[model samples]
Target: MHTDRVYVVTGGTRGIGAAIAQGLRDDGARVCVLARQPDPAEGVAVDLADPSSVPAAFERVLDRWGRIDGLVNNAGISKVGPSLDYDLADFARILDVNVTSLFACSQAAAKAMAAQGGGSIVSIASMTSFTGQPERAAYIASKHAVLGLTRALANDWGPHGIRVNAVSPGYIRTDLTTDLIARGVLDVDAIEGRMPLRRFGQPSDVVGAVKFLLSAEAGYTTGQALVVDGGWTVNGYFK
Candidate 1:
């Protein structure tokens, strides 16, 4: 359904970003995977943490595809530590890659999409976008900013036919989290018990929401954050 549509998926080298890229490609979109370590056959290698390099990386996408039909701001980094010990440099880098670059990439893609009539942008936010998690100050802050950015862009670019939206995935079983689980840093059973679905989500679970938002089917949707969690946000504890 997305045949010939060119999409730029940041941090598409692995995990959720890779899943999104593969899903889009499977459905026929020409997917460009942008990362610090990119696959030559996929797309350019650019460090999103370095904001200065963002535009040119995007430009490379345009150079190859001629135009951008969609963008998935899926690349991000997270540092887990107490707020007191949260290194300033780590915080800044997280914001640079997660929030700042997301905006820059979206802006670049929006311009191209606008010039070509219209396009869709789906950013990967987190369940943290809405709720606070322990020792994730920077990540939570960046995600909140991402949702805000999504809304702002939707408002700013709606007239140009650009739809800006986000996907908030709950504790998905990614390589990162899998490692955490293996190290006993996270309790899989405990997490699953808290979820209404009684299980953790998979990267593929979030991909469908993103694809829908980017497709013509969600033509009327904009400035919305679709939560792909298993009822984590909606679960409230009893007194």
Candidate 2:
């Protein structure tokens, strides 16, 4: 369904971002990955934390692909510590990369899409967007901002045919999560038992939802946060 279309995925070097990029390519889209260390063949090196680098990366995509049909804002970072003792710099840096850079990328993509009459943008939000977890004050706040930005952009750019939406995942098992579990930061068994699905989500579990949002099938969808959590957020009863 994505034949010949061009899509850009930020932080596509690994994990969920890489999965989404590969999924898009499998459906025949031309994929460009933006990352700090990108594969020379199919990726563009861009430091999203650097404000000036965002526009230049998009420009490079436009220059190479001629037009961008979709953009996946998947780059994000987090710092875990007691909220009271959290480093101020760490909190600011999280917001800079997750919220600020996301907005910049969306602005760049929206400009290109508006000129071409239409496009889709999907941001990787988090279950934190809806509810807070311990030691994740900054991450939660940034995700909340992402959801708000998605809605605001949809409202502002609807006239220009730009669709903005987000996908919020819960406890997806990626390399990062693996490290967290190994370091005892996360209790994998407890998490799985609490989740209705009784298992952690694989990165591939999110690919389908993301592809749907980016496809023509979702033409009428915008400003929505689709949760791909295996029912983790909805189960209220203790297991």
Candidate 3:
């Protein structure tokens, strides 16, 4: 459906980002993945923690593809610890990679899209964006900021034919979640028991939502957060 379209995916080396990138490619879209250590074939090496690296990466995409039709801001990091003892540096670093660099990438993409007359931007938000979770203050804050920025940019760039949106995934089984589980930061059985779907989400669960947002099917949609959590955020009572 996305034949000939050029898209950029941050953190596309693994997990949700990898799924999204491959999904786009399967649909015939030309994809450029940005990661610290990239796949080399279609990947552009970038460290999202360093905002300065974002522009050049996008520039590389434009140089190669001549235009970018969509951008997925999926790169992020988290530091799990008590908020009271959380190092300020760690907090800042999380924000730098998750929020600041996302905006940097968006700005770069928006500039290119504006020149080309249109584009779509989909960011990977989290369920923590709407709820509070212990030991993830920085991550939660950065996700909240991501949603806010999606709304703000949608309003600001709508006139330029740009559509900005977000996808909020919950309890997905990825390397990040495995680490959280190993560290006792999350309990798999407890989460699955409480989740309405009664299972942990896989990375593939999020691919369809993201692809929809970036396609003409969602042409009229913007500034919205499409939740792919299988009812985790809406459940008012425990299952």
**TM agreement with the true structure for every prediction:** 0.97, 0.96, 0.95
| lDDT value, residue 93 of candidate 2 | 89
Runs with alpha carbons beyond 4 Å of true place in candidate 2: none
Model 1: lDDT equals 0.92
Per-residue lDDT for 165-199 in model 3, tens only?
Answer: 99999989888789989999788888887888989
Tell me the lDDT of model 2 at 226: 95
Backbone clash total for model 3 is: 0
* Cα lDDT, all candidates: 0.92, 0.93, 0.93
lDDT of 1 at 73: 94
The residue-by-residue lDDT of candidate 1 on 1-239, one tens digit each, is: 79988999999989999999999999998988889888898899988888889889888888888999999999998988999988999999999999998888998899899999999999999888998989999999999999999999999999999999999999999999999999999999888888899899998899999999999999999999999999999998622
Candidate 3 regions with alpha-carbon error over 4 angstroms? 178-185
Best candidate, TM-score-wise? Answer: 1
How far residue 6's Cα lies from its native spot in candidate 3, in Å, is 0.5
